[model samples]
Target: MSKASETAPSNLADIDSSAWSELETAAVSQQSGFRYVNLCSVDAEAKPQARMVVLRGADRSSRVLEFHTDTRSPKWLELSANPHVTVLGFCAQTRLQFRLQGMVELHGSGSDLAKAAWVRLPTWSRMTYSGGPPGDERAFEAINESVPSRLADEAEGEAHFGLLIFRVRMLDWFQLRRQDNRRALFTYDETGALAACRWLNP
Candidate 1:
């Protein structure tokens, strides 16, 4: 095995807050100002569902995590009923991962944040918002194949978009190394205050 791989942390609590924050900052800064996170939510059947999604932004100061998604997706309904969720992210280049647990809130279609986020979207992404409700089970042939002109025009409308905001409650950071693995756990209290932090053997 490689020396770097051999030193990776095996437990989740071996890293410190400062190190964890640094890793998070680096992950957010690399490539497109977005990070892919594995989002986990509870279905109506009480089963856990997980999917990979792009992280739009993170407010470390406020402990807020933000991402965009279609309001018509099942995950949106799932969060509507149960707001608790877990988001996991891994950066291959850094050999680091973040597992965060929090409550989610879906912003309204016409909200200021939604409008601003929509305005910032490029034409290609705006095209996706024009696709209509996501996850609809219509027959393949019955689907609307015509691309809306507004999609290319970059005009925002009722069907344009939605935003998902997650208020992070806890964050676990893991770093992979060749000799030993390092990990750290950070918890925030109900009042949004930082709770105790600790390291664990990875």
Candidate 2:
């Protein structure tokens, strides 16, 4: 193992409080190549489902995470029913993975947060919003499967687009290696202050 890996903290709390800030920075850094996260949601039976999604925003001060999705998607329903969810992300170059578990809040189509998020999306990404209701059943052999194209100017007026904000309560960081793996855990107290971190065996 590398020298840095050898000294890496096993417990989550052992990681410095600034580590959370660094992790958040890594998550949002466009140059870091970690723009996406796998969101895990569970159904009533506790069956788990996961899907890849783009990361929209994060407030390190508030410990809030945000991502966008069609309100019509099944994941939305699942999340609405069960607020608890997990977000997982991995950076291949760094050999690090972050698992964040938190409660979710679904915003409506025209909420302030939704508007702000929508404004941040580029035109190409907004094409996804043009799809008529996500996961809708359609006839086989349908043509024109592409999402409807829209001019950049028209994207802001689309009402169907929405945003989702997740309030992170806990976070786990895992760094992989050939030898001893390292893992760290961090959680927020009731007052949203950073609690102590600890190490765990990977």
Candidate 3:
């Protein structure tokens, strides 16, 4: 099956449409190449931190992407301290790479965003937040001895649930082919209005 943005884009509008269309699909389809995106943030020491995060939602009109994370995770703390972040994803099938620069708004456990997302999460997915804090060191035996337990209730892991809303400001899109590779940059204003679009030599 042909994928979105799989063909050589004819114009800036085409690239813009294809990018958002694929993002919408990626947010819901596990099979999509963009399903998992690399979110890069800065730590307290000013070092760059990057990790894979699942794409949960996409809004083309608002130019926002949604993700879920455990509030106790290092990424959450990093983002809390500095909202500026870079999101990177590539689809091998389409040979397209998207580098997005944006600011993230974090909604903690009791926020409306977190509550709504929590309601939509499946039992197994919700259980992920119930585990020990992320990035914590554990003994090899302790890890090996861990086993899945029956889910307790709907609210079992709600305490650690967090919602990440990333408002995209710029997108650097590139496509690779045997010849005439192409690249474009799209800038969006604070209101998500298209501020500028330009083609660049790739």
Candidate 4:
């Protein structure tokens, strides 16, 4: 069992704290199970689109999370039309699942939030945005092109980079165990303060 499962929270308040704590840890830990989360948004056709995104920041006090994406990606367009989104992550080792409902604020290339996030990205990571728009078909030869090396080359990539700030409104936390399962639901007010919490049958 993982350390999280071994030290599971026994109360609602602790469970809320643990959920945010784990998310904050995941934001900085590549090895964390929650490091890559599924972000779901609704497209223009009213279809649900789900994609995996890296967790870049998590603020417990503000009940906000951060992610970065290429401005040309479909998900970016989808979220632009409808900011409402669902972020989900599960840890197999810990037998824990977190489902968060939130609204995303997009920071475009010229925004300070996007610029700050771009400055923090590593060279290799920044290279991803330098290529053609995401989902565009490219020849194998084009795919093998050299990555951005010069400062000017990297700067171009920053133009396609954007930051997604998700303000969480509700969280559903679930823990699976052999003998019994546990679940709790928490809702936050517009100011990010806890509004309500309730235990649910699992």
Q: Which ten residues in a row have the lowest lDDT in candidate 1?
A: 10-19
Tens-digit lDDT track of model 2 for 1-202: 5565556554444464434555567556776535787999998788999999877676777788778888778888899899899999887766778898889999867788787777777776666666457778766656545444367425543576767888888888888899667777788875557775667667
Per-prediction CA RMSD (Å): 4.1, 3.3, 2.2, 1.3
User: Per-residue lDDT for 122 in model 3?
Assistant: 90
lDDT of 1: 0.71
Report, for every candidate in turn, its global Cα lDDT versus the true structure: 0.71, 0.74, 0.90, 0.92
* lDDT by residue (tens digit), candidate 1, 11-35: 4334434434543564466462126
Ranking by TM-score: 4, 3, 2, 1
Model 3, span 31-134: residue lDDT tens: 99999999999999999999999999999999999999999999999999999999999998888899999999999999987998998999889888876799
Please list the residue runs of candidate 3 whose C-alpha ends up more than 4 Å from where it truly belongs after superposition: 1-6, 144-154
Q: Write the per-residue lDDT of candidate 4 for residues 60-166, one digit (tens) a residue.
A: 99999999999999999999999999999998979899999989999999998898889899988887888689999988887677765667668788899999999
Per-candidate TM-score against the hidden true structure: 0.78, 0.81, 0.93, 0.95
Off by over 4 Å in 1: 1-34, 138-146, 151-160, 190-193
Best by lDDT: 4
Shift of residue 89 alpha carbon in model 1, Å: 0.8
TM-score of 1: 0.78
Off-target runs (Cα >4 Å) in candidate 4 are 1-3
